[model samples]
Target: MSTAADAPPALREPRLVPLHALAAGIDFGRYFRWRHERDGDPFLVRFPGFGSVVFTGTPEGARELFRAPAELLQPPLPNPIEPMVGPASLILSRGTKHRQDRALLAPAFHRSRISAYGNVIRTAARAELAGERTGAAWRPGTRIDARAAARAITLRVILAAVFGIEESRRRDEYTTATTEFLNSFGGALFLVPALRRNLYGLSGWQRFTAARDRFDELIDGEIRRRRAHGDNGTDILGLLLDTRYDDGSPITECDLREQLRTLLVAGHETTATALVWALYRLHRDPETLARLRAELDTAGPDPDPLDLVKLPNLDAVCQETLRLHPPVPIVLRRLTGDFELRGIRLRAGDTMGVALPLLHADPAVWPEPRRFRPERFLERRYGPFEFAPYGGGHRRCVGATLADYELRIVLATIIGTVRLRLSPRFARGRMPLTVPHNIATGPHAAITFDVLEP
Candidate 1:
């Protein structure tokens, strides 16, 4: 067994390798697979700006990483998403603070709360299908960008269900601000830190900061309004407002802003990307699509969103899509003490992460790993370590429940309502490489579908 004294060798010229490995548009899954083949498990990889990281894709490695003592792990610093999610986000917090915040925020996403949002999810999806965005009804022969449509639906759903923003004018304001803020920080800004400079207000960094300020102003105004009016509504924000720390103090304004930003940014984009992938995969395989549609039909035309969530095939399809294209492909943690993963031992400050693409595609666990097969999920149950699309353990995504509920509900709503096929341009073309989009990764080009009938 390898010990700290016999740590796995680092990839040759770690600096040069990561340039290709982390390149903006490269196929990351292919790169990771190639690396795994060459180096085997528990190999060391180092990104240019980030320090050495030991990555493993085996289920055993994931088990060790996820079960590690919470106090011994923290998000690796100089993280690219820090600027977007903010310093106080649950993603960035560690130790006792993280536990307290998570406990306070967990209830807002409880099954009951999420079940209530089913109607909101369905309403947003149906509105998108009806051409509410462009005001021209979608008709036969109309080609639409699946990602864009899914984004519109997800953004609306998150704002309505999570933030409880029902006023039309305020919703539109948030839509524009959030879209602008996210767009301002392109892949270049995320991948290459040097490109984040503000060159006389012309740089990507400058644009992102400006957009963030506008979005923050809106959030702050809403928070202040709620505080001033003592309006304790039932959405996430209200839950946070009602929460108190063990010390009996309310959450500070800064923490509230960051947490809300985290939910807003992390909540919608990842789910939207997953929805697009689901649509693309479903259309690409007629057999899978037929099966899913058959399952949806069993519940009838006007099935409750919650009922759609319970459909076995629908749940399997969603799980399969997440396995194929996890929105956040890697989960990283910096060590606070000595630890070993898959026999590779490491000391304090050493970093390690679970590479989801490799884990999800392990041939031993998933026969025909590259193939799209939802039946595998229905055939047998997978333990959390074996198949965790939202990551795992204590720090697993706080909004995971809401995201899963939304994905199932929204996907069912669309598949049941629309009769569509992949646009010819993308019908037989090779799958586009997934690229970084602000915080999440998605298909390089828009996945468009031709509306056959509705």
Candidate 2:
């Protein structure tokens, strides 16, 4: 097997690479594309705090990395999002514990369980369309921020699905706390670890910790109430409370908090960003939007969201949007044991991942990749490695099923309900660079759309 010395070519000298790493965090697609074009697949790059990582854009490379033994891979420690997700989060755990946690949480997101929430999804979308938030009333000629609107809709759906918090008062409280917690950790806090330090209660980290504490208090109170009342409902939290390990012990409160937080954070933010991108892309391309609208119109008024999710053109549009702008642009795994890939040997502690942007844009896999074309998805089915908006393998997103279902339902509902066009300023504007927002990357500026009379 090839040794460390035989690793893939480096993007730059070690000293200069942190600069590139910072750039990647801001605009991953552009940076990864530039590096992949120059260094070819499986190039090595080092971050200042994190160690050397080899990223590949080829399907073969993705297949190898994802197929590696589950025992030999784990999410890299001191992960930037560790603060946001907490240590016990399944996203960070490993080995037997990870498997057990995954199994326990899997049922909550099963297709059947998610399908049951179709009404919840559609209700949330309709509420948003009718102006749920301040200044968001959808009158013709009124401009609304797509990202904020999408976030509001998704937040409601996730809150209802996870905690069964359908009461407006309680939902508003959770929304306020959760939004604050998420907003506290901005891109700077994520990209520059130094900014994560608590400085006399004035630092971003301090604000985030304060917000987290409040959010935790709310969650802990809910858990205690549920336990006291022996509440056993079908929501994810209740499901988790009732579940037991092989040893017959229930999950600890600490684990429960982390898991719930993970569900709220990962479940909503990523999907919201994708929704925003879908709306942005569709508005920018009238042809694709018209095609999707036509498909939705055929479904008739007041169609069940379950049926909306099955519409081929709607699915193709969501898939195509994800290809161009995956919320998480790369999937990384730190090696726990030596591994070899594409003739390069990587040692324990080294990182390996697939850069989704490069993989999605590979000319061999996607024709006219830069162009906004939803029909490509209808023409041929792509493998997981070729188009993984959610990462692949055992560590693939637990909420994948629900996210996919929600994206299609919500997108279709909004498009079918009202006529919207990109605000004049954004109508002819170039697509904005994506930057870190909370945990996911999204269009840098607010994407605004004007409600139009049908």
RMSD (Å) of each candidate, 1 decimal? 2.4, 2.1
Clashing pairs in model 2, backbone N/Cα/C closer than 3 A: none
TM-score each candidate. Answer: 0.96, 0.97
Clashing pairs in 1: none
The best candidate in terms of lDDT: 2
24-103 per-residue lDDT for model 2 (tens digits)? 87688888888887777778766655556788888899999999999999998778889999989999998899999999
Model 2 / residue 413 / CA error / Å: 0.6
| lDDT value for model 1 | 0.85
The CA lDDT at 244 in model 1 is 93
Which ranges of candidate 2 are over 4 A from the true structure?
Answer: 1-15
